[model samples]
Target: MNTAAPALEMTGLTKSFGTMRALDEVDLVVEAGTVHCVLGENGAGKSTLCHVVGGSLVPDEGGLRLYGSPYAPRRPADALAAGIAMVHQHFSLVPTLTVGENLRLLRLKNLPRRVARVRDEYGLDLDLGARVSELPVGVRQRAEIVKALLREPRLLVLDEPTGVLGPAETDALLATCRRIADSGHAVVLVTHKLGEVARAGDAATVLRGGRVSGGGPLAELPPERLVPLMIGRPADSLDAGLAGTIGLAADEGVRETGGEAPEAGASGGRREASGPAPRALRLRDVSVRRPDGTTALDGVCLDVGHGEIVGIAGVEGNGQSELMALLGGSLAPAAGRVELGGRNVTRAAPRERSRAGLGVVPEDRLHEGCVPPLRVADNLFLGRLERFRRYGVLLDRRAMDRAAESVLTEHGIRAGGPGALMSSLSGGNQQKVVLARELALDPLICLAAAQPTRGLDIGAVGAVHSRIRGAAASGTGVLVVSSELSELLVLCDRITVAYRGKLLGPVDPAEPDARERIGALMLGAHAPDSGAESAVRTAAES
Candidate 1:
């Protein structure tokens, strides 16, 4: 432990947004050449504390010292100048600029060489000439990390860095973190995953209800103790939604598909009942081409039966986004067709698809799900605004407010009220708003949710999963596309793998080797024939 002085220290930090106390009398300490993990559930003041430290938001009260000197950065530039860099959970790159161009904008001397050096050192492979918007979500996330590392800050802060990474990428990034710490840099990792905390951290701090509840060396406070502190409850007390995440047996309410393992690649092996369930959605030979002329989805075919939840598992860039776009009707397929409720919707517009009872919870919630500037009431009634029309023109404000109030309560969203601005809510609450609105529509045929709980806490993840399963129980087919294999196993009736624009296996999660089989499919290790072969392999090892 090279602790001449603490690299960063905060004392009694407090931040308030109107009536909400985001961080209350919080304290944190990070030592040089060590990884300090901040563990917290959503709204536990983790991001707020980070923002105050990074100078993006000024704290209303409290004090901070950098390397034993009084420090208060008036702006992000000041923090940067003080050798502190933060990689936010969200990317902050210009969509129009290329990766290299974005790096050069930092005005760091010898930009190309610095980026090249950092990329090579950290095992980051990015196309410098590719525009930010042209890259897949995963690659863009990598670009963000590379951009931050280019600063070579003494104190590095990363918020949920592995949330979007695949297994290999996550392992590589963790290894890089170790190297960064060994080289005398202090790393502050803000995450909700306990596994990461156990594996990567030297010291850990647990936050609950905007206060520091417990913290100590990783060895002194293992995950078994840390989880309860973060959640403010015993791990065993957790419901079905979160228990399975940490390898604990799920609670009784959590549905588990049971039977002898389904035959791999066999549609017959789906955990759903064997009788002919009506098809809710279908895609036939769907192909998509990116604007940069790459084949994003190559002749993909899929289907989801009513009363079923189909999980799509793959590395982030493997046609998931393209598939989502096709389902949402945001992008037209270059070939093939899409059908919803047996109606050809291949050429339907987004609004038309929604009209046909196709609900979508897009991955990029900040931009696609709801308008942040709008009031909660307006956002809740966004797409269905027509229903509040009294005379086909005059709006019914009172009706909308009442409806919004009902949704807020029914969805269990913790916010001021319907009058509150959507931007004022935390990330998890924002997702609840999206889910409430989408599910309230009673989507008859299909619900396409991509990374529905990307940045939510365990409680929020549980809520989202329960709601999705409830919808399936009501006979609505759901397509859950996520990078988390564990999540797929928890929620889907039949888990499938997508690889390099191709669809493979409808593996039953009941299979003993489901996780390993999914991992193999994601890495393209198994080559079940594209069409019929994918349809009939037994879930058991063949």
Candidate 2:
């Protein structure tokens, strides 16, 4: 045994914001040439720990060491100079620059050769000339990873790196992580997904409520042990068969992996298709053209019935963005029609759409859903402020605050009252705020939610699912657009898969092969290959 100090180590690290503590006496150690997985639910101090190590935030207590020496970094530059590189879950690329230009900013000589080597080694196919703004979300995420790897740091930290990747991309990235670790570099992966941990981790550290619940060799602690550590309860307690499946154990008594999808619906189980329900939302031959003159969505036709939940599932950037924009009324269709509750709303403005009982939770919550600079109270009543007018001219501030307070409480939002800034809330809490506002509208027709639970923890995700289901139960049609297959499998009565600007299948949820069928459709397997496989792979790796 080497018996040397760890590549990196933290002892008694504690951090706080206001009265709440984000981290408390947290400790972690990473060995060289090893992949260490940090497991935790949201707000469990996982990101905070990464931020401290990456020099984005300073801890109020405790200390850190690198290679047996005290290490304290004041900023990202300091950490980078100390041979540490971190790829955040949210991309940090300059939107205006090309991929080639972004790599050049790292100030490394032989950049092209390095990039080419990484692409070959990591199974990535990125277009250097593509503008960051022009690329899809998955492509931009790949660019971020490439940028970080260009540094060739001794210590690499990836915060939820696979969140944006498809299954193939995720496997490739995990293989790349192993290769990096084999070369004697330390790797720290912060993630909530148990499958990834089981597949790639050499060591594991589980965090719950800002403290370490368990830490040991990955093989020693299976998902059964890790799940209880993460949520303070057994996996079966949370959901049926979650523990065994998560652990990849031999005994999967409840559901088969890659087997038939369950034959059930939301909370109340499967509902018989009552013939010919009223259409809550309808799109006929809808098409969207991007500024670059590319057809984002082409001749797409879909509809949702009143009192039903329909899920849209596909790999990221498979016309999902275009579909969302069209549904939200932010983009006018180039051809065909959009109808909300049997009325033609093809050219209706966003405000008009909202007024006609359309509620939307956009994919990008930070930029589109809520204003960071505004207080929670103001943001809650953002688009529908006219209702608060008292004398037809004067605004009623008190009424707004009162309404905000009630919604906040009803949504179980934990904040510094309604006066708290939207920027100050955590990602999960920010999502709750968005949900509170949109759902409170009590829309008559349909509620379209795009990536509603993208970055939430298990607990927060459960809450969001319940609210969406509640809307459907209340006779409001619900359309959920998500990249998380598990979420779609659980939440939707029917699932639709999109590929290459084409929509397929309101596949019956009761069908045993629902997931398999949808996955095939998502990859455009039913029709003769339109080269979408190659394009989607390129999108995944870019």
Candidate 3:
């Protein structure tokens, strides 16, 4: 072992919120020139640890040492001064500002020269003149990383950095992490995916229920040994084949095809030979234009059958967002029709669509899905206040609380109670709450979920998959949009690729080269066959 002093050391770290203790007697160490991974389920104190290190939160009790010197930071600026930088899961950039302008806000000098130098050095290709709000989530992630790298800190903390990235972008970020470590700095990667640990982690620390469960060099501890520590169970006990879906079997050289789609009669399975399955959602020659009058989706045609789950796969900014928005009734199509449950909902409001048995789990849960400042019960019953109205004007708070309590228990959401603020729950639990609310609609005819499992741990991913499958089993047509192809391959019955603005292929996941075919389609490598396009349009119209 090298005898040099470690880059960072924490002893007996603890943090609490009201009656809840987020972190308890935690200890950690990071050696320079190595990538250290922090692994845990959501609410397992990982984000709290990152916040404490980044100076967003101060530990109630702890002692920290930086290169053998006592260190403490009261704010993010102080942490930056001490050579610490953090890239958050949610970006910190001003949405209206350009990348260069955001950098200028950091008070950096030599704007043009330094921005270009850092961008080149870190292989971060960002459009410095582009407004953050106009960029895709993937591009926003790159901007955040670039901002962190520009500081040239001695230690870097990245929290769920790959949650919004595509496969190529994820690979690039891992390579960049390796480069940073090789440059004699310490890097902390907070993530839920085990494949990433195998790919980039030099060492790891596992947290369970806010305490260190197990940790060691990656070489010494394989994924099998780490799985139980992270989720309190053997790898084989994961929900069906989810061990491979979330990469828990990655270190064992498990192939991507190990997790197959559910068998017949299971989720994503076809209905028994009862003629043709009823159509739950259909889009005929649908077209949508952005505010700037640019086409976002052009002449898209699709159909989702009841008891069927269809997936949409593509690189970010390929009209997936617009498609979801159009379905959710937030954006109107320039031409064509959207039918839910065989009724035209072309100009319906979100509430009208909801009443028509449509449920939506939006991609950006924090912003579009729920209100953080409200109580969990209020958020759970949002937009459906009439159901609990006592006198047509007064909300029946007791009834709402009772219903929320049952949902919390049924969904296994960890929160203080229905009265707790939505902001206090962890990301995974927040997502679960959103899902439970949407799925609770008695006659939910169709469900549209976007990036449903992003940033979730192995256990949470399995739970989410099970819930979505349950929805499909109950005869709800499901549409999922995700960047993770592995997830789509396992969860979807038919997969479609979005390129430019057109929809291509209802490829069967059971196809031998399904992943390869979908990848090629995503890149627009070959023009879609005319026959296939005709067949899709026929299915939608029929």
TM-score of every candidate relative to the true structure: 0.91, 0.89, 0.93
* Candidate achieving higher TM-score, 1 or 2: 1
Which candidate has the top score in lDDT?
Answer: 3
Clash totals, every prediction: 9, 0, 0
Question: Candidate 2, residues 419-509: lDDT per residue as tens digits?
Answer: 8888777666787888778887746578999878766665566677778777888878788987777767777777888777877666765
Candidate 3 structure quality by residue, lDDT tens digits, 9-109 = 99999999988899999999999899999999888999889899889999999978876777788898888988999998767899888877887898876
- Summing lDDT over every window of 10 consecutive residues in candidate 2, give the lowest-scoring window: 533-542
Go through the candidates in order and give each one's C-alpha lDDT: 0.79, 0.77, 0.82
Winning model by TM-score: 3
The list of candidate 1 runs beyond 4 A from truth reads 1-3, 239-241, 246-278, 528-542
Whole-structure CA lDDT of model 3: 0.82
lDDT of 1 by residue, 1-542 (tens): 23588989999999988888889998889888899999788778888888888899999999998878888988998899888889887689998999888988999888878887877898888889999887777788899889889898888898878877877888778887888889888899987777677678899988888999999899898555776787666664564435555333433223333422223212323445243443688787788898888888877778787777888988888888888878888888999888888889999998888888899888777667889999999888877998899989988989998988888888778777888899877777788898788887745578899888777777777777778877887778888988777777767778778887887887878778888888888888776645434432223322
Q: Write the candidate numbers in order of decreasing TM-score.
A: 3, 1, 2
Full candidate order by lDDT, most accurate first? 3, 1, 2
